[model samples]
Target: MTEVTVLGAGIAGLAAALALRDRGVSVEIVEQAERLTEVGAGLQIAPNGTRVLRALGIDPPGPESRAVHLIDGPTGRSLIRMPLGPGFHLVHRADLIEALAARLGDIPLHLGRPVAGVSDGGRRLDFSNGQTRAVRRLIGADGARGASRHFVAPDHAARWTGQVAWRALVPVAGWPAEAQVHVGPGRHLVLYPLRDGRLLNVVAVEERAEWVAEGWSQEDDPQALRDAFANYAGPVREVLSRVERVHLWGLMDHGAVPAWRRGACTLIGDAAHPTLPFLAQGANLALEDAWTLAAAGDPAAWEAARRGRVTRALATAQANARNYHLTGMRRALGHGALRAVGAVAPRAMLRRYDWLYGHDVTV
Candidate 1:
């Protein structure tokens, strides 16, 4: 009988644990947090990612966004509109965690157990609490800086992207059942209604000259968020006015790790590659990784199936960061091109990204 140990009980970690358990493999998951107390926010579960969750018999409950619109910050006009794919939806971060937690069944979970280090060639996981565990196989979903990274990819480091992001949920009465990206010079604002349209999730990103801290849980003043985006459009300004709480973090890109496995241990999700939030595929890719890794059971094979696709996602996301912050000629060109797509061949344009929203990784 073989057993697998998973580090981190995050979206990725929990998904991996469930996938492995479904395959009749004994599995355990450990998390540093005493419990799943995720922040209040929203996440986009594109059809590609939601399919993975559904196949696992866990359906994430949330509101279905009708489409994603690229809105001009100054004109308040939509540059483009792409319908959310089948089953594509905006779910509260807390709601998603709760859904996944309910389906864990009998799998062993160790909370408040921080992994200290991994030693003896991926055979031992030393926890900070003076306890150690060994498993025939392991999945490194702890994070980019976790102990398991040493066994999988030792030389990789996260490079800050000279950008900072602010996240907040504001109470709003009536917002379109869609996600909107308000683009402007050097900054962009993404808004989507979550939790039955009771709260609007706002993620505002801007490029900065200096590097900020890297963690995601940093708190920032609401006034600071308002001051940073004071020049945004009317709707964005109104939404920001309703925001009383916010979380801020530096956008750091941990370029894909070239080495993700050693012995029976392998890395997944943020541990293997941490992409900036521009593409909104962090959770999606993590979900895909959970299914693909357990099904393949070979590190090289897993990479072969996933690395190219994720690299493409990372590139697309990076390109968004550039396109969203364009100023003069480039910005105009981008706006014209998108408008043309939206008018001339909307579905075709959507199909152009069939590789993304249409991708079904569970099969």
Candidate 2:
């Protein structure tokens, strides 16, 4: 029997274990955290990402957004409304995490076991408890800054995207059954209902001269979030006013690393490709990487199969950061063009994204 060890029990790690298990490989997942819980507010599992989940028999039971609205901050005028198909599903982070955790039945999970190092081309790993394990194969689904990543690629260059993001979930009785994005000169606010329309998910972002901290656990005052978007429309104001808590994190642009494989070990998800969250594809890309790594059967083949798709996804996300934060004439023109597209032909505009949402990496 082939025994594989996966570092980190995140969405990526859990997906990798399940995929490998389905292929008749024994998988053991080691997570540093004491409990299997998720942070953050809401995440989108685009049709592309959901394909892998469905294949793994894990269907995220969150509401799907019918359309995505990009609007002006003050007027709330719909600049563009991208009509969505069945692929654009909105989910609370915890809900999706729960769904994935449930599907990972019987796979060995070692909690509070942080990895110390990997050696002998990743066939061996030392844990914090001073124990070492030798495995037939290792998958580094640990994340961008996990112990497994350093073993494969010791040095990586990262740059600040000059932006910060804040997330919070507000209570809502009734709101539009769509994803809404309000854009301003240097900031944007996105809100959508989640969990059967009982709670409202909110995320606000702004360009900063300097980078904030790297992690997402840092909390920001709700007043600061409100003050940042003070002049926005009532809908945004109401959401912020209802926010009792907020989590903030810096935006970073980490390009594709050339090497993510060594002998019997390989990387997946953020451990493989880390990018800005502008595209909301962090989890989606991770899910794809997990399925590809397990199904491809070899590190080289996995890299070859996933490289182009991930490269393009990263570029698209970088482009969105600039597009959403446009100012002056460019902002006006961009909004005007989107408004025109919404009024004249909405579905045509959505077709531009068909390549992304239509992708199926489950196989």
Candidate 3:
């Protein structure tokens, strides 16, 4: 039987485990945190992402819990409105974590056992708990700052993208049913209903000169976030004012590593390609990575099959980040063009994203 050791139990990590497990591979997850926790606000599982979930046979929560709607971010106008399809859904990070964690029932998940270091040549892992283990395959899903990147690409450092994002969860009753994106000069705000409309997820991004602390729990002034989007019309101000707790972090971008794998070890998710949230494909891409990695039977063949897809996804993500941070004349020109085209033919503007949202990962 093939045995795999998955590091980090985030979306990518757990998804990898589930994928391998379905193939009758013995999989164990080692997580640094004491408990499986999700701190980020909310995530949208697009059709491409949802396809991966369905392949894992992990049925997500009921439709009532994950209401889906589409709203214009800048003007708060209703662009597209509809329920989440079976192929795409909205979910809280914690809920998805819990669901994925549950699916790996009886699978050994060693929590609080941080990976201190990995021996690439020896295929050995030194854990913070003073234990060592050797495995046939090592998965580096430990996240952006985790030990995996250091082991795989120590020379490459993550670059700050001159932007900070603040996320919060407020009562859903106060928010619109549709996912709202408020675009403005040098700033953007995204909001969606989560947890059966009981909680509303808010993500606000703005260009900044300095990098703030990384991670989802870092505190920033809610008022500051509000001020950033104050000029944006619609429900943004209302949502910002209602945020009781806000977690802010600098959105960092790293150059895509040429190779995501080294010898018997490979990288997944943020560990390999940390992306800005502009495209909202971070978690979705991670899920796709997990599926692709698991589907490959041979290590060598698996790496080759996945390398291109991973690279393209990462590159596209980087491109989207640049497009999202438009400033000055460029910003004005781009927005004017979008608005002009949108007014002329709204469906044409939406069709531009069809290549992205219409992707069928199952193919």
Candidate 4:
């Protein structure tokens, strides 16, 4: 009998399994996908997330990110370059997934088991193959659209954010090991290197009235992406011109779920709270959740302790979305203020996020 059954084999589920198993809890994983695919773009692992990986005895998966360079997208003018401390990494999503999955030794992983529905107050799982299993406890890491999330917050809904993001990879050699954010009016482009600086990851966002489908699998014409940021000059334009393929997804604001637990079941990661990409805390918070849940003696207490931090992080990300797309006078004022801050005390800019990157859950 499994003491805990984690849904989804993505970062959250796999990390939860490893954390629980390390604590001597009997754990198993259920994933709908037949096999883990290499279909993903790059992701940033902040120091907070990196601390968790190190606690789990896993090494950092990618090249250490040295800095974040903010730029003006239209003219390609550098606004500021904030240096990052130790433990920040720019990793491919597949590489991080593989890293977590590799440490899950001998843990029972059930793939190709799409959940049909969850019943019996979250203790019973019904799979699409007409199989039913009663679990002692359920950890819902199956993501926003998965059945585990539905079981925890049945009435929870997400609204489209009037924005869509395009993600792609372009081949580049000897790119700098830093993240660059090209901020424009109502749009922004983020670029960073991955896999020893051989591939440049691009995530371009634009405010749009039309709603495209959500999820990362939706493919759009590379020309559409190019057209969206046609005004961007310099290296930004040059990078977009080389894009051969891209994936597009509509950004949605699900906020935080009303409840993360119901009886023997609880939620983690995207199932509990879906965060915007602006803050890059989705995976980091998931890692924190996995470790905290395994270490907590009481689920309700854990939620209470975790809620305030998650709420703050979500709000920060939302603010960044607005700040990145500032227009007209606001853009001028914001950029000017940033430039002033960057000039006088550039290290102060990075120090502002000490509350975020400095946190250590394992300690």
lDDT by residue (303-358, candidate 4, tens digit) is 99999999999999999999999999999998998899888887898887899999
lDDT of 2 at 198: 83
lDDT of each: 0.85, 0.85, 0.74, 0.92
Q: What is candidate 3's lDDT per residue for 118-221, written digit by digit as tens?
A: 88552788887688888788899999888877788878877777888888888856344456566555676777788777888888778889768778668877
Pitting candidate 1 against candidate 3, the one with the higher TM-score is 1
Number of clashing pairs per prediction, in order: 0, 0, 6, 0
Candidate 3, poorest ten consecutive residues by summed lDDT: 62-71
Tens-digit lDDT track of model 2 for 66-148: 99888899777778888888867888887777788888889988898888888887988888789988878889988888887
Model number with the top TM-score: 4
Cα deviation at 91, candidate 3, in Å, is 0.8
lDDT of 3 at 64: 27
Could you tell me the C-alpha RMSD of candidate 1 in Å?
1.5
CA lDDT for candidate 3: 0.74
If both were scored by TM-score, which would come out higher, candidate 3 or candidate 4? Answer: 4
- Measured against the true structure, the TM-scores of the candidates, in listed sequence, are 0.96, 0.96, 0.88, 0.99
